[model samples]
Target: MEMEKAREALMVEEEASELVSRLDVRPHRAGRDASFYEGFALRGIRVDHIQPGLLTCSFKVPPRLTDSSGNLSPGAIANLVDEVGSAALHADGHHMKVSVDMSISYMSTAKVEDELEIISRVLGHKGGYSGTYVLLSNKTTGQIVAEGRHSLFGKLKSKI
Candidate 1:
C-alpha cells in the first residue's frame, strides 16, 4: 500500500500537470501519505531551473519549518538536500535514484521568512553510484546556511 501510494505520488508530467490543476482549484493536503517532495512543496520549496547535472531551487522559510527557537530545522535542510540532489541526477538522465548515504554540515542558521537559494549538482556517476552536492544560502545576503553531500545509486533512463 505504501509502495502504491509512493508510485502514485511520483507523478509523471501529465499527472503532475493534473495535480497542479487540482491545486489551483483547492489546496493540496495529502496528510501522512504524501511523498517527501510533496510535503516539501507544501512547506514552500520551489525549483527554479534544471540543466544537465545541476538544479536551482528556492523557498521562503515558513514558520512551520522552523524549530522552537525560530530557526530553520536541520531536518528541513536535510530534506532539501535529498530532494534537490535527486533532482540533479534526474536532470542528468537518471530515471530513479536512492540515497545510500548523506552528510550535512550546517554553517549558520536561517530565520523564519528567510528566502533561501539552493544550488545542487551531480559531481559525477560511476557504476550504480553517483555523488551529489547541495549548498543552501541566504538569497539576500549570500551567506551559506548549510552544505550537504549525498551518495546515491541509480540507473540511467535508457539503461532502465
Candidate 2:
C-alpha cells in the first residue's frame, strides 16, 4: 500500500512539473494594478532629496519588514535597492527601464524603528543601457547596512 501511495505522489509531482515547464512569459501590460509588494515596500519611505542623476531618501525600519529575530529582512532591503536604484536613472528620461543585473553587499543589520538613509547615484548611461549605485546606512549609528550596483535597459519611445 505504501509503494502504491508513493507511485501516485510521484505521478502527481511529474504532472505539476510538466505543467509549469509549459508556461511562457509575456511582456507586462501597462494598465495592471500595482502589486502588494509595491505597497509593502513604499510605506514610510520619504524622498529627502532629488536632483539630476541622484536620489536620497529616508525610511524607518517598520516591524512589518522585520524577521523573527527583529532584524530587517534581507528581501526588503533588496527591494528598496531595486526601487531607489531605478529611480536614480530617471534623469536619463527612460521611465520604463528593467533591471538586467544587480549586485548587493550586505554589511550589517538594522532593527525596527531604525532610520535608514538611502542614496542612489547614476554611474553611467549609454543609449538604452544604464548603471547606478545605491547605499543604505543607519542614520543614528552611521553604519552601512548594504550597497548595491544595478544595471537596467529599456527601449525608448518613438515620437510620432
Top of the candidates by TM-score: 2
Runs in model 2 lying further than 4 Å from the true structure: 1-35, 158-160
Where is the poorest 10-residue window by lDDT in model 2? 22-31
Angstrom error of the Cα, residue 87, model 2: value is 0.9
Candidate 1 Cα deviation (angstroms), residue 145: 0.2
List the candidates' TM-scores in order.
0.73, 0.76
Candidate 1 lDDT, tens digit per residue, 24-139? 33354676466645755445778899899999999899886798899999998898899889889989988687899999999999999999999999999899899899999999
RMSD of 1: 11.0
lDDT of each: 0.87, 0.87
The model with the greatest lDDT is 2
Query: Alpha-carbon error at 83 in model 1, in Å?
Result: 0.5
